[model samples]
Target chain A: MPEGPTLAQLGEGELIRRLGAFAPPGQFDDDAALLGAALLGGRPAGDPPLVLNTDVLVEDVHFSAATMGAADVGWRAAAANLSDLAAMGCRGAVGLTVALVAPGHTPWAWVEGAYAGMAELLGSHGGVLLGGDCSGGRQRLLAVTALGRLPAGGGPIRRGDGRPGDVLVSTGAHGISRLGLAVLRGEALPDLPAAGRERAIRAHRRPVPRFDAVAALGASRPAALDWRVAGCDSSDGLATAASCLAVASRCTALLSRSDLPLAAELAGQAQAEDWCLWGGEDFELVLALEPAWAEALVEQLEGARWIGRLVEPQPWGPLGWTEGGGPIASPTAAFRHFG
Target chain B: MPEGPTLAQLGEGELIRRLGAFAPPGQFDDDAALLGAALLGGRPAGDPPLVLNTDVLVEDVHFSAATMGAADVGWRAAAANLSDLAAMGCRGAVGLTVALVAPGHTPWAWVEGAYAGMAELLGSHGGVLLGGDCSGGRQRLLAVTALGRLPAGGGPIRRGDGRPGDVLVSTGAHGISRLGLAVLRGEALPDLPAAGRERAIRAHRRPVPRFDAVAALGASRPAALDWRVAGCDSSDGLATAASCLAVASRCTALLSRSDLPLAAELAGQAQAEDWCLWGGEDFELVLALEPAWAEALVEQLEGARWIGRLVEPQPWGPLGWTEGGGPIASPTAAFRHFG
Candidate 1:
């Protein structure tokens, strides 16, 4: 074994970057990988690109049976993959395959509940359940592969399409899910009103993918402006997601702190800013689009919020947060997969 | 929990069968689930059906690091999924996505080598590694998804297409992988020669998918006969796989004990029959075709062995083994996920 930093020390981003080096170039650097006839630019005119994305949720590591129910685990696992498809602006997932690994002593009802949860979600999104494998393992593991279709004429919204002077808009809020996580962890949300607390908890339990939002935005965009839309999900926090988009597009995102859509009940919480900046599990999409089109899109969508703008590459880094002044000090925190 | 039996008691097959009943029908019954435009049987006139399959390999349960190298684990994981595609007579896979869950202390070399093994196997089959997610878990888990494309004009060969009087063919010798597993488990194989032992170990360690063989078989068939080709991999042993096919097609499989394509070295071994009938991990495909086509196919493909014939529903059962006389006593054993 080669001596080096452990995966916990290297973290998810660096580990993925190192593993990506093992694969051929241009393979693992996308939100949802585009494969099949779509690999080449010519997809036979009418054939839509097939987008594939997978996510695995492990017992204890991703969720605890004591804190989370079996159905929620299954729903969240499917949602995580669906969000990846949403990042690419895919219309909707057509196929869902789930593989479950669990202990032999596991309750049969838990397994059935999990599949029921997945079925319910798929039914709502016009997705169908494909065949999957079942196995016995020491711990419970759920792996979901969501197969989606790109729009016929409109191309997918990749993370590397943001250009200088583009407007950065975010769909919905970011910290609600994170706040909900805190509450789920039994942390007291004393400042939050009852309704806000309930809403945040639900957000954390069932994070919805932004597929409908992206579809509406894509439909309202002008033909020439379609190609410039760049976006990715903020599952790893707004900071990391914004930085990833900026780095991929070779530009800088100057986010206005005041423009963030914070829940009203979180106004008195001191950690609200921290939650918005570094909290994870928020499935909202952060997108960069041409300025005029972004404005039009925001107007078309009910609650789309414009919070930042892309500019020339910055010397310090790809992300800059401003609060009615020059860029504020950077926040170097985000959810870590391993600790 | 509302359960008559735990997952362990129900075993993998019964558990999956019961769980599958919760979802809408027509899914989870095929080797590779067909989705998207393929679901409707109208794939834009010229496009091929999209075939998707996922397989999960768990540490200790599927492979132990002490017994198997990391590369072998990765290779076998991918081969499992590819075999599912071959079962459907899909030409080849286009995209491969892998989700890996391992302890944070896992060596970087192990992960890299695993990816290398997957890359080498995929390179030979014209498949590319798409993006996948990585996370921390208690034990090592690898989930592989191989997306394949059926040949244009012809549809997928389903498990339920086996007709009465169709001849069943085994792609290669069985029990090789099972014997390999025994050897790896430190069991004494006194009768096996060094060369045979090495071959068995290779079969278990780095099993190859039969994509090329299935493609050739499907290609050689006449257009109208293509859809009638029924097949599936014998990962769950010959008896179980044949029984599954029979049950799915509402027919019966009468297997000839003498006609089984057992590895030459495995003959005369006390456990050879048991391994051939119930030893899992054999990646060879079992195909059911019309009697005349099956004979022609065996001639066209070198080393292909005719094992049995599918017949109309029989009173004895869906599966029976004959040894030139009356049906022999059936073996009730198979590789179980939980036993």
Candidate 2:
């Protein structure tokens, strides 16, 4: 008999690794797989490639109906899918398809609110809910499909494209959504300001994708396989995403602890760094760019900050955290699906 | 207080109708909405428009774990989405996105089999799984999004395009899948042949989409706002789909009782017509075309059969059943999500 850890013990990453062997080569390793890489025939040059992604939110797994509203559920699901487009630096989302499964007794207002939330977010981002399916189920579930066009000139920025000396950058704050979830889940903590709690809750409930920020980079032309930048959405914690980038690019990611941008509301929190490292669901982009272009690119985008740098693979590890002098213990904590 | 029927009583279609008011006009009424109907700017003329559709399947509601295998679940879900594209006469499917949510205790083999089934079906249909999200949930659920391309030099044939003089046609047999399900569920029967039962079970377990049959019609040119045909997938029962088309096109559907192509296994079954009318999940295309073109279309496509005709709206109803003599009773039964 075979002896091995179960899926929960093996974790989401391991399961993905095992499943990767069955998928088309080099396709399922990124935030979203590129379609038509070999099938887009007769399409005119300059036609933007279509980038598609899907996300599912289960009632208890992703959000508890006891705490989160239906509108928030819809908004968060859309945001998750949109973040994948941002990871690829797609021009903007053009359309979305959704499937909703819930009990027969579920309120109509809840569903209406869900659609309103989807429409509101997509409209603001220049996208729309084009079509969807709804079915009755024992539990509430929402699945969203987002479709976007790749930038006219630039191809997708993949995790495997990071060079040895690329500067690691990120957009927006980290660990905020996780902190917000803690607040919403009623995890008791030291005396905290009511305003801070509200802010954190809002952050966890509503995340904005960095599509506009990445769209700005689309002006860069693709020539001879040289990309201006490479990255993926850091929804699965900074450490996990960075480690994945490291493994894919065959480089070491030396992430800086002091350079981390903690959420404003998480000040004085003891495990703030821990959350920043492995508290996933941040929906921020962890980008890698040439050191020479980092400063100029940061200047062009808002809320963009440099956090670390990619270097030659070290024998010790592929991921490392450093403060000032030397690398400290690497954090193994990450939000895995089964875990 | 202002009240009529709640979502559960009004059912899925009514809820969609009420919610459709909030969507872009006529967009939510079709199998797949056209994204660039008003936004296709700078896009070359002859480029095929993208067709998108979504379907969700949940445990207990869609299938029972005891009866259905994981692969069957995945294959059935994909077929549902692909059938939507076939309803629109899309040239062919190109890509798909899926979301799977299941508990940690679920067997890893089940997940692998699910993927294998999806890959096998999509590959045979000229499509590939692009990307998807997987998470841990209380109940196993699957959602699929299918993306296809509209045929070159042709526009989509919408359900609302049916004319009063049009003949109603369907690809393949109806009620066969429902009979198959009954067999799988071990419903008591009148000593039906084992071979016939096996065939019905296969139909229910592995339904195919009519993409090729519809693609053949797209070769016909679109001129002066006239179209070759209009229809939708009969996942909601033939009666329900026919009624929807009649409502959309402002015509009455006059269905012929003897014209229905029932499965050979149900030849002597007294309840065969009931299953054909109300037992949904057939995944067959129910098309409406002009009388002049129906003959040619049947000749071009295998297993194509004429089922009914459209007539001017009568005072009594928008859908009617008739045989060699007087009008028969209309079927009020439909497979509703929340019914």
Could you give the fnat of all candidates in order? 0.67, 0.54
lDDT of each: 0.80, 0.77
The regions of model 2 sitting more than 4 angstroms off are A1-6, A188-194, A218-226, A322-333, B1-7, B37-41, B219-226, B322-334
Candidate 1 Cα outliers beyond 4 Å, as residue runs = A1-3, A36-45, A223-226, A323-333, B1-4, B36-45, B222-226, B323-333
TM-score per model for chain B alone?
Answer: 0.93, 0.91
Residue by residue across A1-339, what tens digits does model 1's lDDT show? 456777887888888898787556867777878764655333475666678999988888778876678888888888888898889878677767888988888888888888887777777765777778888888898999998877765677788988998899888777888788787788877767788888888888788888888787777787665466888988887877888899999998888877976755567787887888777778888899888888888888877889898888988788887554344454565446665
- By lDDT, the best candidate is 1
Report DockQ per prediction, comma-separated: 0.65, 0.52
Per-candidate Cα RMSD to the true structure, in Å, reads 2.2, 3.1
Q: What TM-score would you give candidate 2 relative to the actual structure?
A: 0.92
